[model samples]
Target chain A: MDKSIPSLAQAVADIPDGASVMIGGFGGSGAPIELIHALIDAGPRNLTVINNNAGNGHVGLAALIAAGQVAKLICSFPRSADPRVFNAKYLAGEIDLELVPQGTLAERIRAGGAGTPAFYTPTSFGTDLARGKPVAEFEGRSYVQERWLKADFALIKAEAGDVMGNLTYRMAARNFNPIMAMAARTTIAQVSRIAPLGSLDPETVVTPGIFVNRVVLAENPAQEEVLNRQEAVYP
Target chain B: MTNPAMIDLEAVKLTNAQMAWRAAQDIEDGAYVNLGIGLPELVAKFQPDGREAIFHTENGVLGFGPAPAKGAEDWDLINAGKKAVTLKPGAAFFHHADSFAMVRGGHLNVAILGAYEVAENGDLANWSTGAGGVPAVGGAMDLVHGARRVAVITDHVTKSGAPKLLTRCTLPLTGVGCVTRIYSSLAVIDIAQGRFVLREKVAGLSVEQLQSLTGAKLHIEAPVTDLTAAQVA
Candidate 1:
């Protein structure tokens, strides 16, 4: 457990281009704005990123996607409304996209943390999502063995962190940070406040310090909400 | 004899179990609910079936629904124990890290549960007590603690003829003072002042008969009759 905290940009600038990254947030909430902004400033192009949903229009993960640094986006839903720009320019042929069912995406990341090579889940069994995936039957039911999903770096957002790196996520912003921390080789967190170790309730800490490699502090921005629209524009 | 106990039992169409589900219909829309396995799953079958309230699974679901089609049952799309499922519009998938967040964070409005034993003090021990061994305490720990309101549905008596709603739960605790309201075959009870506040009584059973079968005192609410089946929404 490192006791030092650095600026968000300094922590993320070391990550090279083409790295496997996982950002934590659901919809447009709880995104690590400081690290994302830092990554954009550093301009490490051609990277692969994973998250539950794409950032919503420059507020969440939307910042990185907007900066043209993301080479390929592997996600279930990209509701940020900027995928059109990504598709026309960066993803036209240069970048790639792998769209997956939400269940499969979570299981893959969970498998990474559980140390399971692969486990069969009935989630995408009969759908085209099972194409080329390992198949098996258990207890009179069939499932696909979705492979483990891990990354080189998992950038997470937390409401607060202690010197020991124990974390507490605030509300819906709590999305994928804890599991992503376990699945990544190096986990960095941006927290609004840094407290002494043992300050937070053990019952409330979502992601523990053991999985975290670095702690960065920045005044995280307020959460942005996605307004409901009649027609979704994504292809 | 004076009032002439309704000899006509013909209008009742619900099975013994469906009667229980009709009792569950009182759960308002937009409520956060947890449906236990078995007869309780049927509650979903009866809920005003549209996008009204959120259905949560201890295995990790916040916005997941649209029950599976008969043929396209994907075992993976299932709930906590891996049961097949369907997805509804406006449903979004999350890494359970966030789903449980909603639960533990007190974001849930209600949780409908199935129980084996509900104590007078609202203690519950529904997970285990099978013939083979102690039950596997899976996600029950999380769901019990996380859910804001826990309403249980179960039989009034155990298979061996002992009261299921006892003066105090005999099995290990799930959550301390966790339950809010209880719906059983013989009656519906709300925990009031560390005791069972009987809200409704079965048609055939009297207050004394219901009380003698229990380990706790019963507070009876007036006009106790069985619930009626609602048109499926």
Candidate 2:
């Protein structure tokens, strides 16, 4: 089935307020900036965003947060290169945060996509992050149990995509995009180029079409770090 | 009592670059290693000649090379520290799940990290100070326990001259009984049998002088070698 969409705004128009979204990126590498901006323009409220970092300067995710679209942030690092936006909101008690270790966060999203309910890991076993969680010992080693994290929607970026929604990402940009695509109810992808259906090599497709619901073209998308450097703020 | 004047000279303490260089010498060839953000990132610059270590950044890239020249950076290619990077010839990219799986699944050879404090019993505290601010714990907790061998590189004492190698960590921990070795500013020590085993100290520094700077008792096991590094131009 063809999953290609015409416009960024239309692709994100259906996302409602209070939705839990998993935005793909590790500090802007694979962040779906256009899709995020589209969602911001669509004007959703009370969103709980899942990302590696909360946001950098006043551009992408920070702009979304500044727009008052996010109510909570679920991430590993809230303090980014420039975390002024998140810091202000958090210190003022205007937003909530659920901090998870980076590996555990990735595993939780993987488990959610794979239909696993819960799993045990040795990470954060005796720290404040593991407090209030059930702990069990296996073979003389203790591990804390973490639950799966599924989202209402996932916004992701890709290097190349087909109308069938098969996606491939470039270099380090592949960080969370592929897994976030599977962990959400609906996955919206912004690709730099839309290749023909048969053009993508089957063996190299990082995310198959089955997990993707919508694909939009975002050729020459703005880089978050560059935008932050230019001190560009969104409306 | 520690003699401050006797230990304050550059000849007695290893510089940050020397400490990183000293730590990099121990990495075996063909090992998969993860270097933590700040001080640990310097380790990549001094990999021993004829030995190649594949660098793993938690962000997704494996086999990443040094930073690209000015204006040659691709924003999409960066390290776990979110700094611009370039890929080596044989580099591979995967999703975050697989990247962290390489970390949490014990597929990495060594993980070098910066420490705020390390207990004699091998406990590590580097993530937070429990201060009144936003607490951010990145992939540190996982790297400490997951890598096959965990080593820390840091100044032996705090900037205010307080001992960082302690009998017990006063701050929150990243992992319990996880660290195995430390390359500090003044010495190379190993954490074994719940004691600080002195392996090496900087040239011209006496055992008593080094001991005076440490929080815990330094047990003399083998003859301490001079902690030295090849001078980098």
Candidate 3:
């Protein structure tokens, strides 16, 4: 019953070159920076990374992209605050991008986790984005068929976790983390703090322990401090 | 949204806030609105009194207030754009799926968005130009297609002076035939029956001048009237 926390290196050591990974976050808010930094330092190449934005500034996934670690990026927003690295790589044909609409991205990840292979959504219907995709009409409206988005591993960030891996997220930081956790074969969460099993309330747990395989505490406490101050106002 | 006061309204013809203010007048009272990033976000701040429009951000915050005051930013609280914002009373955070359901399920009454181009036929192309670039399409596709009414706010022309209201969008579209109205720096245009009709224009601008600047034909059904300063204020 013991799924002990591992060192950041051991946590991501299983990730190999060309593995499809889902990294969670809207920007840097809920990003698991320490684990991502470790992954970058571990130096896996040609990886396909899925996330919301490319990355903000020169940190997190951006650092991984800047290191030339990623071969493809499947994201909703590829352009962020400073997207020069991705822009340059994309324009030069050094990397590839598969842009999905945000809502569809979330639902696809959710669908992937829920064992649904595909679903019809009205989003992006009748547009170039819907081009060449399977289309269906229900009640006189068009819908594009989007397949489930699954990955070999999901790297996520959470506010807190119990020893059993029950997790909770802070405010908007919960963005893509929970969905990615469900959508991946192996889910590793980087959390601010770990509590005892009985200390976490069952009703409040956002991601039940079954979905998360490993939990690692953030290397930098200051990052957690910033999030703490941000969430301080809310319960 | 950036401060509208900083913009040279005369040079750009209309400030972003003024454009938002113009759009706000059309939004009815007690409407559930979703404001997209950039200029559309300013619409919430300018929402007139007596109209209690509940704002929704796709990242799962609803009843969100305007941007937090400088130095008072809370990292935990952010809109879908990843910018820090204050939460209004009764504001609630839910799962991303539910937030999007409110959008895709057509629970939202109106969605105000920024656009790259809008064709005369009401096709919206705000996500990307599709010219060799990253082409990040966020929730624009769902918001335009799902919202009951879609309103676009944008510059009349690009920085390079290319008209954005076109005969047909040469760019990748976010949604087809989704735009109901357009509030631009130069004029308030409505898309009806596949034509861009002039509703009102900023002072010192004429329908002929608008036609010269617009790539598509401008249909003037109503008497062209000056957009008074008080109306924008």
TM per candidate:
0.53, 0.98, 0.89
**Once model 2 is optimally superposed onto the true structure by TM-score, how far is the C-alpha of residue A230 displaced, in angstroms?**
1.1
TM-score, B chain, candidate 2?
A: 0.96
Candidate 3: give the clashing pairs: none
The TM-score leader among the candidates is: 2
Tens-digit lDDT track of model 1 for B111-215 = 666777888776777655544321233334445556677778776666555677877776655554678887775667788677888776656556766676666
Sort by TM-score, top down from the best:
2, 3, 1
lDDT of 2: 0.92
State in Å the error of residue A228, model 2. 1.3
Query: Which digits, one per residue and each the tens of the lDDT, describe model 3 over residues B150-206?
Result: 999998888766688999988888888899899999898999999998888887665
**Predicted candidate 2 versus true structure: per-residue lDDT over B156-227, tens digit per residue:** 888778889999999999999999999998999999999999999988788888888899999998899998
Number of backbone-clashing residue pairs for each candidate, in the order shown:
7, 0, 0
TM-score of chain B of each: 0.82, 0.96, 0.90
Which interface RMSD values do the candidates have, in the order shown? 15.8, 0.7, 2.0
Q: Residue B192 in model 3: shift from native, Å?
A: 2.3
Q: Highest DockQ: give the candidate number.
A: 2
lDDT of 2 by residue, A160-204 (tens): 999989999988889999999999999999999999989999999
TM-score of chain A in every predicted structure: 0.88, 0.99, 0.92
Give model 1's DockQ, 2 decimals. 0.05
Using alpha carbons, what is the TM-score of model 2?
0.98
Query: How far is B104's C-alpha from truth in model 1 (Å)?
Result: 20
